[model samples]
Target: MRTKPIRALATLAAMITISSTALLTGAADTHAADVHAEGTHAADIHTAAPPGLESLVDTAVTGYLKDDRIPGAAVTVVSGGKPVLTKGYGVADVRTRAPVDADRTGFFLGSLAKLFTAQSASQLVTEGRIDARADVNDHLREATVPDTRPGRPVTLDHLLTHTAGFDSDLVGRNKASAEDVEPLAEGLTTRRPPRVRAPGQVAAYDNYGYALAGQLVADVSGQDFPAYVDTRILRPLGMTHSTFAQPRPPRIAGQQARGYRPDGASGWTEAKGQYGSWSPAGPGAVSTAGDMGRWLTDQLTADSAANRLMRQVHYRQDPRLPGLGYGYEEWRRDGRTGWFKDGDIPGFHSTLLLLPAHDLGVFVVFNGDGTDGRAAVDGRNLIDRVVDHLVPARPATPEAPRPSADPALATYTGSYRAARVSRSSLMAVEGLVGAVTVEKDGDTGLRTTGLSVDPQHGEQRWTALGDGLFRERGAGGATLAFTGDGLLVSSATPATAYERLTWRQSPALHTALLGFGLAVAALGAIAYPATAAARHLRRRDPHPRAARAARAAAAVTGLLAVTFAASLAAVVSDANAMMEAVPLGSPLLTAVTVTGTALVVTTLGVATGAMAAWQRGWWNRTARVLFTLTALGCLALASMLLLYHLVTAPLTWITG
Candidate 1:
């Protein structure tokens, strides 16, 4: 018994040592995996975002990039007024194995740099150096505003407000180089007579107007517009990484992502779009997420005179739309207010959103213009989602639903709107599916999709907590709460909620449903004949049991073929619509059809031979081989489709 206890003790000690070794080894492997996952090969680097926010950030980015097959993307976010999340995802250059980084990622701010130009203009007003309403002519010597009426010469206010009636697509204004500028008067005449409404009658967003605004900065300050912004706006904010250099400055190195365009048949090919040095309104500035966060912090500092100046509602109406108010460069979207700007070009799509209401900001720069307007708009919504999560404190009654007596919901329900709203929150309790539509004229309409409210998700319903406040879902999968000021503020994360309703449609949606039905019918017609032929041969075969098996195989093969064909057709239709051409025979279509046909042929051979070979050894062997080949082929084709859909398909509306 003494000897037995000693043996037991020794065994216990050994187990302990083994357990410790296993844990240490496991830990080392995990650490190594993390490092490798985030390692930068020079073309792109992937790093973990700050904890808690990583899933949200990664999911959003992965979906956005994969859906568009973007070569790479750089992302960052601010939490607690500090850079909490800064990371790069995907390859910067596939051939080079280069890693993307915050410091080196190069993206066109496009028109988003307008916020900087506008901020600089606002700063001048704060310093008593410029007037928001002064005659732009006073600052001009070589260029003059095109006079549409004898006495109604466009004023500085008119240009700043985008109501100068200048054409937005001023192509010639963007010269071959940023150093080139078409004469201001020249840009006006080559186009139709200026469509000048009464000055300030409508707030039209014009690239040329912003370019003119940039020019005014130059004429008044006696400095190039790019230099003026760098000194007066960027440098003051300590944004060292932001620049508008014609050729990118040397300081920005290694981590920059190359811009690309979808080649006609070449697929995702590279291109260098216009870079601005002369035309400040359009594509000129290059920036990264870390630098942009610094700029946003400076813009949000209430103590700064620049912030106050920027908040001034100069035009008091959305220059881009009616009813929405314009404050210097920022826009007032109903009760919830924020500064918003977006950029788009051949190879890039970018956006910046500053929610002054909650001291929150989000900036996104994508490698491709895949989503067009929807990407920027959706990016802002994602920020709002993050903000909501950060804003609301846990309710005291944790396990209980928010009470009906909650005062916050009542205060939030008043007629509030954004210049461009996504959804109306009037029916906050009903969720999106059943929510009533509030028309432009403020009329209520029924939800055409029917009502769908699930309180369990906390995502699809308005959950009433205490204090009259309610948690509501935002467009970006974030939550928002009604503030006492009649604004929908993010409950946890920092965000501003706008009420744009342009995405809502009844007639267009109906047509889409009808198209889907037609597509399904067409697919069934194409597949039925193959299925019938296979089923008949199997049921009437020489061997009764084998015939039954063949019939089952036929049914499965026919179903699979039909489903694949329908999905392929839908993708082709969507691609055609986007490109404005029937892509009759592309490499993409060829790949899909070739793979599907191979499977069909293999299936037919196996099903026919299986029934014939029930008692014949030779036929059975052939049938078995065919079955194995068919199974292997299916797996290979699946792998190829996954790779193509996730990497190179330019317009994948189906997956998107």
Candidate 2:
């Protein structure tokens, strides 16, 4: 949490259920007739406009692009298997002054590519090439999944629903260039993330799981992942403008849009660092808004196995929690149930939502993260706007507190960190900074802080539903349930689960301990030099060697402590950059490693020196006491460094 922007997005996400599920159940022939009577594409707006909806979209988009400084964006909306609006906004390339074209400009679809991966696997299920319930390794030829859980192998269903329990791993998953991209299986086999949870136990957004799914599709189909998608999925769906290829195919290379970011002042800079080995996880896919529109319509109408899977909930943490269906995240917003898939890579961000109940869908993409990541916020806001206009949510009835406390409240009360964080590596630091606190607010009502806080209210209020379940105090909100195994899953964000954080892993304790140590270090750092100068001028020595040795050890400890803190600050300042891989070669990472090691070594020196001081009586009692505190502070600093695994030969934030 770098402060303001993250907090804002968190507020919006918690309130919007940006937070709830489905543009899909099935599309009937009647839907076509209904749309024909209403309208078709944006072109039909003048003849058969949906009143002021088009104008609202245009106004909202224009304001968002300008205010957010988004250089380029593409939006697609489908209603009843027809395009309601398919358009582009702003310039795709600022330097060329090139305007974006919905049918031509290809935008990266980050994690949204996971939808295609799910579809491909579902296709195999339809043909009996693979069983959805079988072990994922059953179909694999080149890449094999280790048996992390005996008798409960991860299935294709688990992969699609993000219930496979693969620990998150992004570092080095991407290559700097298309030429550097390796074969799918080879890339997946290397550095595969360890399974931290059993299959279907908890859901954590996993790029590696999709990568594995893509490899399975490839092995069974005897085609590359990209080729399999293009031939079987894209071409069949009339998504001719989309491809999972790294370098765009010659047919669409010239038509591709360049993703961008703000140049800080007013200009736009090309965003880079987005090529990877995993074609199925979304880093390799690119599509135009028009193509995405077609895909949306097809997803809502198609009678294929993938479509069938999309129509039903494959996984829900709680009965009231509308979780994941196939690869799409499910939600219930404004009395409209919808399924949405969002993608994000460097320079590109996209969201695709399908409301099966209404036979309507929306696809949004931006070339930039936007002013403080508002593109993501605005994307959800745009969906809300559309859903609100189309189907207004009935006013919520006021909720009252439950009369009695749930017997399971104690079991649910604890600090939790998202399951998406890597526990084995240095990346564990992320969980500490982003911990969620669940507290018993009243007799039976529980307040969740930092997990899913409502924007209007500071924290989310929930009335206990007994047996470890919680219903939102407000209407149009998510349901939360604590699993028997200490995992918290919500209907709002089904992509990930929160695992209980142990007391030692608590950031509150970390901050307090580190602050105390750093304070002592800071004082010692200045005092050592100042006092040394005084001692030299006085030209009086009563045990110069002993006093000097102890002072030197404390001084060295102080220096390393400062170095560790400064380096850590530099690393965490931009966490988005570290997602794919930690910058192993960065001087800052090296500084942390070196300083941490030195700090540990010097702490030993300080400890030895502290004892020597006591035994030899190096100074007056007051000076001796102060030095002891200094030694304890250095010891505390060392313990924290070790606790965070910062000195683990490899740094946590760095891929190295």
Q: Summing lDDT over every window of 10 consecutive residues in candidate 2, give the lowest-scoring window.
A: 18-27
The C-alpha stretches of model 2 lying farther than 4 A from their native spots are 1-49, 148-152, 263-269, 394-412, 442-444, 453-458, 463-468, 471-475, 540-550, 571-598, 615-621, 647-656
Local distance difference test, per candidate? 0.46, 0.71
Off by over 4 Å in 1: 1-51, 171-195, 250-256, 262-267, 276-278, 318-336, 371-374, 393-443, 446-656
Best by TM-score: 2
Q: How far is each candidate from the true structure, as Cα RMSD in Å?
A: 18.9, 8.8
Q: What is the lDDT of residue 139 in candidate 2?
A: 84
Model 1 reaches what TM-score against the true structure?
Answer: 0.52
Count of backbone collisions within predicted model 2:
25
Q: Please give the lDDT score at residue 566 for candidate 1.
A: 43
177-282 per-residue lDDT for model 1 (tens digits): 4445444334433432233355654444555566667777777788867788788877877777777655556675334566553333223444333453334665
Q: Write the per-residue lDDT of candidate 2 for residues 1-656, one digit (tens) a residue.
A: 11121222122112112112211112112221221222212322212335676787778877777777677677877886688777777766655556778888888888888888888888888888889889878789898888867887988888888889887655445665677787888888876877888888777777788889999899899998899999998998788889998776888767777765544345544555567788798776888898888888888887776688765788876565678887888877635678877777766778778888788888888877665555666777787787788767765456633545787676678788887776655455556556778988877879887765223344888888777878777656567888877888887777787889788878678767767887787678778877888888998656658678888888878877776766655544433322222412344555666888788888888788788889988888898899999999988877766665567454433332
